[model samples]
Target: MSDYLIVGGGVIGMMMARELSTAGADVTLVDRRGCAEESSWAGGGIVSPLYPWRYKDPITALATWSQSSYVLLAQELLEETGYDPELRQKGMFMVSVEDADDARRWAAKHHRPLTTVDADFLYQKEPHLKENLGEALWMPEVASIRNPRLGRSLRQSLVGRDNVTVLEHQPLESLIIEGEQVKGIKTHKGEIRADKTIIAAGSWSGELVKPLGLNVPVEPVRGQMMIFKAPQGLVNRVVLMDGRYVIPRNDGRVLIGSTMEHTGFVKETTEDARASLYETAINIVPALADHPIEHHWAGLRPGSPEGVPFIGAVPGYENLYMNAGHFRNGLVLAPASTRLLADQLLGRTPIIDPAAYALSGRVTSG
Candidate 1:
């Protein structure tokens, strides 16, 4: 019997498993398809949300904490696994002025440095950007990581750990409940008993927890992204216009993403979305129009009602916890969310107030 059985092998689940195993708990992680191949792998990996000031406190708290810890975490992972997640602190450039005032206010309140740059400075920073694009906001402290690399490194780091068991391609069928407690989980293979169970199943978390009568409200929000092969310095930093973004990797690949669709569980990439993203990319950086498209794919983000993830005990159930509904920010928020969930499970005080993320807390818009 395992001390903890985590359902889902996305970044959130893997991070939770790592934390639990590091703290001397025997943890078993099961994934339906494969670990980290879902939203965690498909995300753009910007360390902060597209518009940080737009989200409420509950969402910002976790994001900020995780953002603060990513540098050290990346260093540790690099040392342990020799896989650089390519943690880049090149900063984020915002071109949209729709919510500039609101963003400025929030930044001031939160002590985040938000600078307004003129056209000359913007062109100096990112020469490839479209000319005549007026003033923009520069968030200097923002950073990004290669999310797929990070996920792979986390999995690699767990290979020889005696306390961790990672099971891929094991789809969970149902939960084994006894009165008010969750006994274990029923996978396609067979029954596996556990002292506690955590559902970090990403977009599929709602279906897995529905049998237990816990309405987690986690639904699949499909986001499609396109990759373009370019020179290493084709795009100098992360660029944003409205909700879409362009991320340049250490390698010569530039990632342009994404569209949030309400389609239910369908991960297919649409040509329309591809074209739309291509147009958006070229609109920001005209040079991208000359680049060849390398790849196009989609992933389903675990979206909650208010875009905030649940990271606490399941109401009315003992030994059951959840860490899902992160929507588009899972990659950025995973570190802090996992720490908070692990602390709660181990009877330790959480780094942030757990009330806002509790299962019973009132849902608020991000």
Candidate 2:
């Protein structure tokens, strides 16, 4: 029996396991697929929330905490696992934005560095962009990591840990419940017992805990993305307009994404999404139209109500916990979410207030 058993081996599960195992607890992490092959791999890896000023305080708190930790974490992972997650500090530019005053106020309140630039400034920064876009919001502190590389680093790091046991392709059949407490999980191979169990199964998290009469409210929100092989310096930074974005990798590959379709577990890529994304990418930078689309894919974001994740002990169970329902902010929020969960499990001081993320009596409405 392990001290902790994590059901999903995505980034959340791996990070949780890392946190616990580092604190001298034995951990066993299992996944239906291999680690980091799901939404963790499919994300664009933007470190900040899209339009940071628009979200409520709960999200801002988590993002703020995680952003401060990412730089150190990335360096540690690279040194330990010999895999670089390509964490880059390329700033993001939101062009032709509305609610400029709200953005300013939010930045000032949070003490994050933000600036407003006119069209000339925007053109000077991003020469390939469409001209005459007016004032845009620039966040120079924002960073982005390559999602696939980050996944690889996490998997490698977990495998190298002596106290961590990874079980791949082991699907969780059911939760072992005994008198209102979850003892462990029953996988296809056999029953694995643990002192504590966590359901970090991403979009499939709600289904895993439904038999326990707990409504986690995590659904699969499908997001489709495509990549173009462009020149390395074609697009200088992360560019966003409306809900879509264009992220430029250092190796001359530009990523364009995504559409938030509320499709249930349908991970298939659609022509409509591809066409829409392509149109948006070309409109942002006309030079991108000349490059052929190298790849197009989709991932299921674990859509939580109000974009807030449940990250504490389950309400009705003694030994069960949850860390799911992050929606589109999973990659950006993983570090803080895992730390909060670990802090609670280890009986240490939590980095932030835990009341906002409780599973019981959660305010799902805005």
Candidate 3:
């Protein structure tokens, strides 16, 4: 029996396995499909929440902690594995912010730098934008990672470890529960026993635990995005307006995203969503209309109450744990969330208060 069994090989599970395996624990990570091919690959890789002022304290705490660690973590991953998870400080422009006071309050409380800029500043920074773009909130410290590369680096690192095993294309059949103890998981191939089991199955987490009489309020929310093949330095930074965004990658590709639809595990990309995203992208930067639409895809974010994730022990099972339900911020929050779960499992002092992300506490707060 391994020391840990992680179901779902997305960012959360891979990070969890990486953490525990680094601590000299034997870990086996299984995924229904290819690891890191789900939401972890399809995200915009923004290291912060869509709007920092919109979320509560818990989300802020996790995001801040994870953001702070990403630079070093990316470096470590690159050194360990030869893949570079392009972590770039491209900053962010929040155009047409509704409540400046709330944003200022959140920034001041969190010690994040925020500046107000007029249309002149917007045009001067990014000349391709449409006219009368108006004022925006500039956060110069914001950064983003190329999450698909990050996923590859993480998978390589995990596979290289002597204490970790990764099984892809293996579907989890059910949890092996005896009384209140979850021994391990039953995959399509066979059952694997472990001292502890963790469910990091993203949107499928709710269904995985429901048979055990736990109604974990995690559901799939579909988000679609389109990419434009623009030249390098065309779009300078990440631009957010009206809950939609355009992210410029180091390579000439720019990302335009996304629509939040509670469509119940439907990962299909709709023409309506693609057309809407294109319209938004062109309006934000008219030059994008000249560029070719390279790719349009969709991902399922694990939606939870107020966009907070549950990252602790399961309610009824002593040997079972969870690190899912991160919604849209999974990539941004993965490092800190996995670290906290590892801290709890290994009896180390947690990086933050464990109660806020605990399953029972989340249920109560919800």
Query: What is the C-alpha lDDT profile of model 1 across 144-201, one tens digit per residue?
Result: 8999999988888776688999999989887898899998888889998899999999
Candidate 2 Cα deviation (angstroms), residue 113:
1.1
- The per-model lDDT (C-alpha) reads 0.89, 0.91, 0.92
Q: Which stretches of candidate 1 lie over 4 Å from their true place?
A: 361-366
Evaluate residue 175 in candidate 2 and report its C-alpha lDDT on the 0 to 100 scale: 90
TM-scores for the candidates: 0.97, 0.98, 0.98
lDDT of 2 by residue, 1-366 (tens): 999999999899999999999999999999999999999999999999999988879999999999989999999999999999998897999987778899999999989889998888888889999766888999998999998999999999999989999999999999998998899999889999999999999999988888876666889999999999998899868999987899989797999999989889999999999899999999998899999999999999999878999999888788999999999899899999999999999999999998898987862221
For model 3 the local lDDT of residue 357 reads 85
**Clashing pairs for predicted structure model 1, backbone only:** none
Cand. 3 TM to true fold: 0.98
Residue pairs with backbone overlap in model 2: none
Which 10-residue window in model 2 sums to the lowest lDDT?
Answer: 357-366
Error of 1 at 161 (Å): 1.1
